[model samples]
Target: MQYAQKPELYATGTIQLWEDPHIAKGMLEAHLAPDNDAASRNHQFIDRSVKWLSTLSPVEAAPKVIDFGCGPGMYTSRLAKLGYEVTGVDISENSINYAKEDAVSNNLHINYRNESYLELKDEGLYDWAILIYCDYSVLSPEQRQTLLENIKRALKPGGKLIFDVFTPYQYEPLKESHSWYAENASGFYKDGPHLCLFSHFLYEDDVYLDQYVIIDEMDQVDVIRVWDRSFTVARLQQEIESAGLKLSAYYSNVAGDLYNEASKSLCFVVEKW
Candidate 1:
């Protein structure tokens, strides 16, 4: 007897990282990993980011800031401690709860919202808006444009929007492949006896897809898809300008380091006025 072949198609997103209980639990675990050396995932990077933001001309005076995709209050709490009025927004309820708890424990006054950044409004209120962790790169081109417009609308005149995006150097060398793993009551997929298949695919438009297919003990199958869009300086400059924002500076990794030709990711600073 032969088992039926597994279906191969566009990965259906069911095991959501930001929503499902198991996935959310896994995400929170990743966010709180007790290591600072991991850039973008720990406190050392947060400190570095806050220090770099402080060096920016607009942030030198501690202007009100909006931290979009502000997971676990990493950057938001620090910015608030640095004396900038802060509002943090994220989609994960768990993360937002944790962020609020952190804010209260630190005696930091910060407005934390559990919502989508695409729904952001409150025009002309923020002096600075930031979307870190390469969150902007995961959005579609249209969504990117909308996000920029929303950020622009939310900014005060001359206010700036800062974000980061991975360039070709990060994606060009990534080869598409598939793999399998066993999850026995641990890992991103909990419960017992899960056969997980992982896939990576690249598109012509610099979009990359990372998908997971998991079949659990009771024969329940789940899918999750993550998209990453890569960019070049010229292409990014055009996109920023098209969104009605003025590109002011581009740096390597948000540390205010110069963006050289070989940079894997570049951080952008754009002004609304």
Candidate 2:
């Protein structure tokens, strides 16, 4: 008797898929779904960011703010409503289009651009810059430095830069095994109820890799892999300073508490001198 060889399994996906226009649209819509309670979360985050900004010395009347990687325009809409002239930029054209449509539906005037953050020009025009959702960690050290330099050139003297980063504590526990599964009737209507398996690995000091396998009832499986990095407070501070920005405050939470080693989030408030 002859036995067939078992098939080899390899993680297969493209950065291009994540950057796809339609896929980006679908993902954003899913997050912004009316019944998802995401709207409430958006409002809460915006309220907290606004309160923090209010504590700062007011910028010249009607400060201009830019939201880098403004997915679906959630925070962009919030900031605009708070009276800041807001512009949202993303690398996905589809996401930008969706954001523009969303702004129209909400009757909010926002500038939505389909451009990479690195390509944004410095006209010395902005008063504030924000990179939320731990997005800044996506860049390499050199890219981060370049981004800071660009932000500084884009801001007026004394303008501020605020962003957040994940800490090492979050990664330590994530190195363990984790898995979850869910099933629902919506399967026929959309990407059906599925079972998800997750595996995590600490690739380096600040880098982690997560593999996600989604299996439908029919045994079809789709695997997605994501890689992310965490930044230490000291390393982050050094980058900010090297970029010519002054670190004025650091908080471990959205509510503005002093940062501790174990804090999962490191929110930064830096001013351009």
Off by over 4 Å in 1: 1-12, 34-39, 57-62
Provide the TM-score for each candidate, comma-separated: 0.91, 0.76
Q: lDDT tens string, model 1, 1-273? A: 011223333334776667777778767777777574322456677678789887783455547899999878888887887788899999899999999998888899999999988888878888888888789987777788788888889889999888898998987678878788887775676556798888787777787888777788888878777778888988999999988889998898876778898998889998987
Instruction: For candidate 1, give the lDDT of residue 240.
Output: 91
Among these predicted structures, which one has the highest TM-score?
A: 1
| Among all candidates shown, the one with the greatest lDDT | 1
User: What RMSD does model 2 have?
Assistant: 5.5
Global lDDT of each candidate: 0.80, 0.70
lDDT for residue 143 in candidate 2, whole number 0-100: 66
lDDT of 2 at 261: 75
